[model samples]
Target: MTVAQLSPQSQVAALPQTWDLERRHQSMRRLVDVVQQLSLARSLEAIMDIVRVAARELTGADGATFVLRDRDQCYYAEEYAIQPLWKGQRFPLTACVSGWAMMSRQAAVIPDVFDDPRVPADAYRPTFVKSMAMVPIRTEAPIGAIGTYWAVHHEPGQDELTLLQALANTTSVAMENVRVWSELEDRVDQRTRELDAANRELESFSYSISHDLRAPLRAIQGFCQIYLEDHGDTVPVEGRPILETVVSNTERMSALIEDLLRFSKLSRQPLERHTVSLDDLVRRIVSAQRAAAEPGREIDVAVGPLGQCEGDSSLLEQVLVNLISNAFKFTRGRTPARIEIGRRSDGDEPVWFVRDNGAGFDMRYAGRLFGVFQRLHSAEAFEGTGVGLSIVQRIVQRHGGQIRAESAPGEGATFSFTLGQGS
Candidate 1:
């Protein structure tokens, strides 16, 4: 063949093939961009907006509709088109091409709407759509459909159909992700509301106990003191012991009320955190305890390098006071009460501990150790309001820390704790 004649024939054949390849390549590139956008979409509305524009551009279609299956009806929720086809409209599942695609769980290609038995002729007669293609959003169980329309009689190429289906599949995942996120947000909101309500109730209860209950308790204690000081000698010998019992109980009641008030205040107070030399704090508390100790009592205290920690100084001091005070109170009968205060090495975190060779408790009761008003020993064995350990626990938790106790009967007790970053 002559060069000129061969060139004409070759050019004619190569031109269409090259054009088709370029079109497919552009469609795929656009699909990639659409997929990226869909992945970030947090709402169904966002997904709809993305798919509407991409569907028409990827297929070179004149119009595209984002359809959702509303029960047995196909709802045209959104659209992007040269001319409006169905922006807000509904049709029976059997009567609409989009609905048919979702119901059958496959893509439907129609070269001519009038020639297809599935498409309602009356519906297409007033519209510009002649040829159309619809793909289900999901393959196994379809939720919706993506429909592309052409004004002229045309059959979509296999490449275009594949790209459209790919877009549809991605849309399904995006929609599911949006649903899951929305549900999670709702659960968090509900939990927050519940916590707020519970906190408000606790505050009200604390206030009532502080005022209403304390006034009467104060009156009882005051009267008992007056009776003891003014009329003590007049009472019969046998009645004197009963009168003393009333005075003793009033003092105990006052102490319990004070402990309760302190416990309540701990929850409302905000933490004033800073770097604190725990060694100094522990020593100061122990010094005060020693000064208040019985004149002849002997206490052997072993203080180690407690080091520095991030925490509220006053609150941390209270924790140490409660633990050390409990040690002194429990080891009353010991010849020389032994108490140890120090920090031990822990992986990536600091662990502080208080140990005492005191009248220790059983390990089985350890779970109840931090609960309010939970005492392992009888009132005669240990004189305490039982709110001290509970207060210690609350302070540790507020500082982003955890407190645990370990002990057995006759063995020393150890209270160990860890503080998080804020602590």
Candidate 2:
């Protein structure tokens, strides 16, 4: 009110300065909004367009252009203006202000385009641009520049220069984000393609093993049986033992192929999840193993309360079979084999375990435990194809779970697994 009481000339003189400050504040607010929107730009072209338009509007420029550094050339890739400007044009770095800003790594503010020796006179003679400012997109290792033009001879204020630099900085970050996102997408696509090709090859191999390979094996087994039945008396005693050995080896090979097929199928099979009573499943597996065990061998197996878990029933059954069978197999020399199956709550997930007083392995070889055909014991000590644990690991992974073994040599082995969720 006291200022208003003064002369009208005083108030009028102050109005232009006040309006200039308000305009700059408004531009700063708009720049903030532009930067936020630019962050979400997914492509380079979109980012360029956003930067060009924001630069023109925020600085009250007659036109705006985004010039990208392409090798030794400055490419005018995009433009936003009331009149036609250099859009889709390329020039040498020596002849363009945008290029000059990028080369110097600083902002270029020219009040008179013709008076500046850096300005290319012939190139600007036909344009409405009498003054312009160019700012490097990035201060360190500048990638490009943002250029703004005016129709009349004008000097860019500090506020205008600052706002343009801010826009240029934001544009650099947006461009970088777009590049990183594109690279990530490409990598993901490449990996997906590789996985698809690998799966196809595995299917072909599985087919060969099931049909082509099995045919020859069956033929050998059949011919051996024919010789035993038809020419048993004609064959010599030593020759008969050799033929029996051949038959036994063929049977073992058949078992190996079957297990191989199962292991391969796990990679392709989709999971079917349901709540399964592990208590009942473990009991059935233990009963079967006991039946197949050596006659008169008493194995004390304690079945504890095994809580329910959500997983593929058939796959989980296979996991229990492999683990429990290993327990029984390794406990061969013990007078009374001790095996315990139980469950406990660990946080939100249920941890189920199978413990057995068996011939445990050294912890040093644990890294190779889940590999295909990696066995801790020799064939003479424990007979297996060494594919069981690998299959178990794959199944557990498919069910969004984990399986790990704890054991030391000459002590005992305990396998603990958690079924987090069904995949």
Candidate 3:
């Protein structure tokens, strides 16, 4: 006889009713409510609860279960209204009809579960599900199976199978959305920690730079002064020049220390931006540099009618000083050399350029030009701490600006950099 020919009552003395249309309608209504609730739920636990409740009612099966297929095993992921079909249980993929549904990626309605050789008799006997509808709950792949079952034999017709499949579809989509949300949260948390670590490393680097650079400068200055004071008269003429060299080296070191401190402080402080004239700032910087220059050196300062910019005056002054000093120092060899400090409008804002017929840098070394302790010329050729351009670069960067240099071995350099456009 076919599986259906065997009466459900005859096959199992304790079989459930299969053709109760009124009972089936009530079960399906409860299922529709469950699917709607699952759709609105955000939490995984809530979604699973809806799935289980719907499964229990729709199948009219005494027990229902949700299984999570992990690797090759199907474990009781969650349970529902009925005495569970082996509640909190697990079964191997090679052993049961539910596992077969998971592996095959399809639904199975077994009118007689044990009648099919695929069903594990021992696993089924515990919470007798003689009639069964197993639906795979899937998102990316086969994740698990949701099954509605009977405690005794009852043929689950097509209507019950359809309801079971619908519930599984709802669970699959909801689970996938929740999994994606969890992964995104993890990625954001990891990125935040990485950024915090980077900031701490930068702070440690700054502290080390300060301690290592200034400690030796103090000793060089102290020893140079002591030698000149104690043994000035007895020292030979050749020795005196060497002593003078010591004093010069110490002074240069002191200047370098001051420049480095200034650069470091700039990075930590907040900018005090206000409206100021670019043209006026340049003129003042030029005058001060000329006064500090060897008594007779000329520098021509030319710029268009002043344009107003919003920025920190003190930092801007330092930027102008560094750029102008570099211009003056480089052009020292030319008998009547000229240094021009100028500014012009680029689109809506002013762009500044310092052009000089003085020492120019090689283009290949341009990459290192704006790094602290990065020097293009040797101390023998030009006297500087090499930290000035670095300061200039930082100040420009903090102001959301950009800088560039154009120079060749013999050709004079032109440093062009732009600040934000003035309103």
Candidate 4:
């Protein structure tokens, strides 16, 4: 880009033919300082100081003043203070040379304020102020003006005009930065508010699950128990199966309620990762199942040595208990049923699995396996609330891990899960 293509306000001033080259070079150095200050400083106030100091030193004027346009045209705002001259002075929008440049949208350079027809008479009565130079801050319409006033009558040379215009151009860009920064801060604050609202909606959903689920479950359990106690003897033998059905439905409902509560509690609770012995939790659950089996039924249990993992001991125990219980129920009809609990570490955190030789599931229905209340078998063929693997999925996800299922009809079922690993 050529210097001629620069902003009109940045053009070199029309200088007198007799001006010396040394004075002009000094003016160029001061203009360099103005551009560097605008680029380096962070805040608006520091930038205004750079402009004030640069403008005064470059021209050797008695006093320089800079003003900016405000939201309302009632006042052209004071932008900077340079002392010991016009540090606290202000020029009104309607009655000063500064006002003329802003209103006309042009640079008004007055070599002698007293002889200039454009100068306001009322703006100079009380002081010895004589000659002055005023220039409009152009480029995207003049927002304000910059000028210097001398105490004695004198004319401003071309080099002095050139220096003042350069200072004015730099001030325009610095002002624009302040405006953009204000807009960015406002946008950030708006996004913060939106995130806060979404979190509150999630909290409300959790509350509904806690209070709404438990009420209906209590009613189903109470009425089923009442029917078995009060009407079992009087009911006909054919109606006995109806009472059994009610009892089964209530049991499934109770299990569903418990699963919902556990899912809601996982995130808010602190994790207690300990080196756990899965075999011990497995043994306890199996022993209880063996004691609860029906007449003449036997399910053999085989458990391998489980490698350790970092997880809450109580929670991991529950995961094993659910998977094993599902295995036992699904394979009860087999003549010689078998259940195995085993693990493989393989350079990662241990992954344990439960395999059962019983009625296996179709692979096409695999995606529905871990969803709550999803069942592949009927109540008569195998009894379950269908929440076992769903609980396993939640526990695994809490530990930053995953769970999977593999099975086909009549072959058997295997449920496995891993925790805390990428290997």
Local distance difference test values of all predictions, in order: 0.88, 0.89, 0.78, 0.73
Q: Is candidate 3 or candidate 4 better by TM-score?
A: 3
Give a tens-digit lDDT track for model 1, residues 217-280.
7788788778878998888899888877887887887788788888888878888989999988
lDDT of 3: 0.78
**Could you tell me the TM-score of candidate 2?**
0.72
Error of 4 at 109 (Å): 30
Best lDDT among the predictions, by candidate number: 2
Per-residue lDDT of candidate 2, residues 244-314 (tens digit): 98898888778778788888888778888888988889989999999999998879999899967788899
- Candidate 4: residue 141 lDDT (0-100): 76
TM-score of 1: 0.74
Lowest lDDT 10-residue stretch of candidate 3: 11-20
* TM-score between model 3 and native: 0.56
Model 2, backbone clash pairs (residues 3+ apart or across chains), number: 0
What is the Cα-based lDDT of residue 173 in candidate 2?
94
Q: Pick the candidate with the highest TM-score.
A: 1
TM-score of each prediction: 0.74, 0.72, 0.56, 0.51
Q: List the residue pairs that clash in candidate 2.
A: none
Candidate 3, residues 1-423, lDDT tens digits: the string is 543777876646323444355677787778778877876877778777778777877776777778888787888877774564555667788887778888888888777877877777776676546787788986347888898777667777777777888788878888887788778888989998998688556655765676687778678777877878998888898898887888887788778767766776776789988887777788787777788888776655454454667888888888888888898889887767677777676776667888888878899999999998999999999988988999999988888888899999867898877766532
| Model 1 clashing residue pairs (backbone) | none
